[model samples]
Target chain A: MTAKAAMRKQFTLNPAALEQLFSVLESHDFQIVGPTIRNGTIQYDYIKGCKELPSGWTSEQERASCRLKRRKDDALFGYVPGADSLKRFLHPPELRLFRAERENGVFRILDNPAPAPKLAFVGVRSCELRALSILDRVLAEDRYPDAAYVAARRRIFIVAVNCTEPAPTCFCTSMGGGPEAGGGFDLLLTEIVSDNQHVFVAEAGTSEGSGVLAVLNPGEVTKEIMAALHEAMDRSKAAFKREVATEGLRELLYESFDHPQWDRVAAQCFLCANCTMVCPTCFCVTVEDSTDVPVRRAERWRKWDSCFTQNFSYIHGGSVRLSPKSRYRQWLTHKMAAWVDQFGTFGCVGCGRCITWCPAGIDVTEQIAALRGTAAPAASDGAG
Target chain B: MNSDTGMKPKIAIFKFASCDGCQLSLLELEDSLLDLVNAVEIAYFPEASRRMLKGPYDIGLVEGSITTHHDAERIQRVRRESKTLVTIGACATAGGIQALRNWKDVGEFVRFVYAKPDFISTLKMSTPVAEHVPVDFELRGCPINKLHLVELIGAMLAGRKPNIPTYSVCMECKRRGNVCLAVSASLPCLGPVTQAGCGAICPAYHRACYGCFGPMENPNPTALAGRFEAQGHADRDIMRAFRMFNAWSWQFRQVSEERERR
Candidate 1:
């Protein structure tokens, strides 16, 4: 049998067996990281087992607000991406490049050398996986490869969950990313909850995943389980409230640079850069050098930057995008148009984090709809 | 002057008509304070030490706002003596929270706050140091960030321009991967128009940005104000948001006036 066929063996894992999967990953010296409720928000952190997952909880997300709500049943991976992402662990917000110390007029530079930690990410969403893949392409380009990113990425083992309950903010379907995970995971899971049973239909995508499955010794994945998995995925696909039409979106954005819609959207944009910050694909950075008062020692560091910032396009004379209209235009057009030219794929994964997390409640779908001259769904007014 | 072979740069810290928060920020650099002392001569800093050194200083770190006639003249002397004049904190960079009085009558404010209103000698408008004298650079924040302060000192010592950003707080928020408090929660945030420095602290804690660091390079406060209006915010609330820490800042002042007109 082919490797793909052999790895495609599926089984139904009960709650106890799922716990064993965590133990198996632990045995391989991988620190298990998963979602947990902390400070009234879903944050990714170190977890011992499935107990740490946000069970019996769901998140209500809208433009600029997120709230954790109680669910009728206990579903571990019921929520979508929170404020945090794989970028935090991989690229990191602040990275020290090197430290320089002047000794006897001779400047000696010491490079920051830290090894990447081996981590097993549990309950990673499909859109997030697509985002990680997008980052992989950006950070691992032949011209300028990030050593830290490559190391962290190589050490990660993803445990993806196919969405049975996608958040209202989700539009992964339109982006051709999700509702169902296609690839880019070590193991994939589909949860099914019936009257008497709660089981996960597990499928291994790699040898490592299959090894963990072997340890779990799950029950046989009968035809009924397969049907349940399909039903769950379909339910998720139907749950998406918004859809972004990507057909000729690149060409449209490129041609409509001066669209009146730009001015309309710019009026609402705070240029606070929350959209770029929360975006899974947005990767801009800035460098800074710091030294002690005596100028004896200095260190260079790199931090995350955004296009929405005036200095991002600044040269010797002045900033390139002086007005909010131009800055908003630059960001949207880059994501929809220039990204395809640069990365060979659409920049946005239609995750809707940008829409839900906007303090102004600016919806990307609505903005795009305006650009396309189509009537969008009435913008959510925060009313139930 | 110490005429040793390795002559460290002479640095001084000055304050005007505001809180001493930014001066405390320099002391808050506990880890690097000793290193800083070793790198430069603290020629004059009343906040840190009592020993006041006369100037012809290499770097003058000015804090607070120009809110009195005495301060208005004092800054000119500071400008003449210092080779490089750097303004630290919102007060020195953009007139700070005290500038809110600029919209109203300062005399009324003096009468309300002080028992002896006639004894108070204050300018009608609280203004930044740059308004009176040329500033080499302006380090922004309510109390400027210690990291940026260190970077500024380091760059000055190295005889190079400091690498301070003119970006919005939105960039810092994104870098930290925090959700947008304004968009997600329908809160009024000035982060888009405010400069990046405070590391998006307010939003991380589920509060909107108050524009403590002032208007970023070429900000559009009118656009953000329109957003606030569309989100069912009252005109007064939108106006109050702009009239906070950086009220007297040109961009915010203009936007606030525009909203009032509307």
Candidate 2:
């Protein structure tokens, strides 16, 4: 049970005049945050109005490639999420914890206060919604809570849009998460059969969601319209081109820790640390202290870190996992097998961002399959 | 390494066998360095300070590989004194770019990288820290991330598990929105096999990775090489690609060996 509970409601939206939808949101005293083109990616940001959104934009993504193209029709929420999830907003890359200043003969620590505001996050995708929940588990943990994260998460609204199209790197289905926002959203919008009438079957999941709906003054939605929306969702789920296998992953990885394959993989691994930076779940970090010159004030801060770095495990007079092979094996085992022992869930979300964006184009799904006992000889096993 | 009676974790950073890029990153911590100094007592780091302290330290960071009898002996001694031993850098991990010599006669490499083998003390192959002792954890990357480095220390200090990824580099590139160099430009990339740590730097730099970080969990290098081949990379080029910084990694080794056979 959480501190707050969800409420439910449903309605239909006019897709052709979606700008009116944005205006309606504005009229309700909600600040709109939605997707817009930025630095060659469809990123979410605070928009001045509907014109700031990528109204006529579409993106092309594959296993190691992505590009944006202009669309023929002016549809506001037509594109899939770019590389970032809502985690970027909730848990920022850089955050200030506290400041230490010397006043009189003593050192004083002042916590950085956060400004909480009511926001309406539009175009929320299913995978991103799941990612947000994953973050919720991490930041909102029992023992040690991330105060900064807690501050950013209060009194927010989520507007989840069903995926009408799937990107090549998407594999949320394998993660048992989605192309759909089942429980983590305030409003779920399914765009179904739009030509003369651009319609979205909207459903509310919280009291706050109901409050937002009451402001929209939207027309009634019948059972037939809801059935059509369900059909649209089914079709979108079938459109995913990529998938990840989560069956028996923990048992297989735990049992195969000493399998010779780790050494084989280590042979070609660069140990670059790219996957950690983009992973939605990796939360390792280190603390540092900054000192104010001419004074005795020092403030400690935490920053993100990875296990792939050479100095990550240095202990005593030496390191235990010295080789890339062993280090890599340790990380792999922990993420898939041991993480379940610790977190009671597999760490992977099957987003496939690690595959499509790697400079080397590493495929995690294929590697897991190999570890699960499908490792054949190298396809180019004898070219030297 | 010096513990200084009962103080913070006595940290020691050591290096051997390869270029000092990873060690340099420690010094590169810049503003974070002072805070790090307060977090742990850096008992022995020739690169950071001149004060040498003797060991039986708490945490020891060993970089580079065991390429000689002396190095192997030194690693054993390092393992003996430390409470926890962590390996830093590629040479100490996948044997660095130098492990490529493990595939060939060391004499050939000696003739290539050095002018005088007569004065050099050498071993048949370069190896990572794990080959020597029991390690508590391992940080990947040619030059490990400063942030990840800090996180690992914090985890150890707190006696908590560190959260590092075991996935591939492709995830990072996508996060940064870098166009896929391999698929879009037909560049040979090892993102499929390499561990995730480097922040997708190479792809951001418009160059494919050379796998300096070593292999991630369950890397499928061969399937990826085939993809490269389909993009018009020749068998020779693919082998060359696999033979870079992490070339000696077995997954890559087998892939290139397959290409070498064809």
- Using lDDT as the measure, the top candidate is 1
Model 2 per-residue lDDT tens digits across residues B1-262: 2222346778888878868777788788788678778768889989878997999888888888889989889888988877888887667776778887787898777788887877777888877778777777787777777667776776665455565656667655654556556644556777757877787899898888778677876676776777678677899999988887666667777888999999
What is the overall TM-score of model 1 with all chains considered together?
0.91
Q: Tell me model 2's lDDT, rounded to 2 decimals.
A: 0.70
Q: List where candidate 1 sits over 4 angstroms from the true fold.
A: A1-7, A141-143, A377-384, B1-5, B109-118, B177-180, B183-186, B204-207, B226-233, B258-262
- Give residue A381's lDDT in candidate 2 (0 to 100): 24
Superposed by TM-score, candidate 1 places the C-alpha of residue A170 at a distance from the truth, in angstroms, of 2.4
DockQ for each candidate?
Answer: 0.54, 0.09
| Tens-digit lDDT track of model 1 for B1-262 | 2223588779999988768988898899997888888878899999889999899898899999999999999999999999989998889988998888787899888899999888999899999898999998888888788889988887766666677777788878767656566645567778888888888899888888888888987677887887788778988888889987778888989989888877
- Model 2 alpha-carbon drift over 4 Å, by segment: A1-9, A16-31, A69-75, A102-105, A116-119, A193-196, A222-224, A292-299, A318-320, A374-384, B1-262
Task: Determine which window of 10 residues in candidate 1 chain B has minimal summed lDDT.
Answer: B1-10
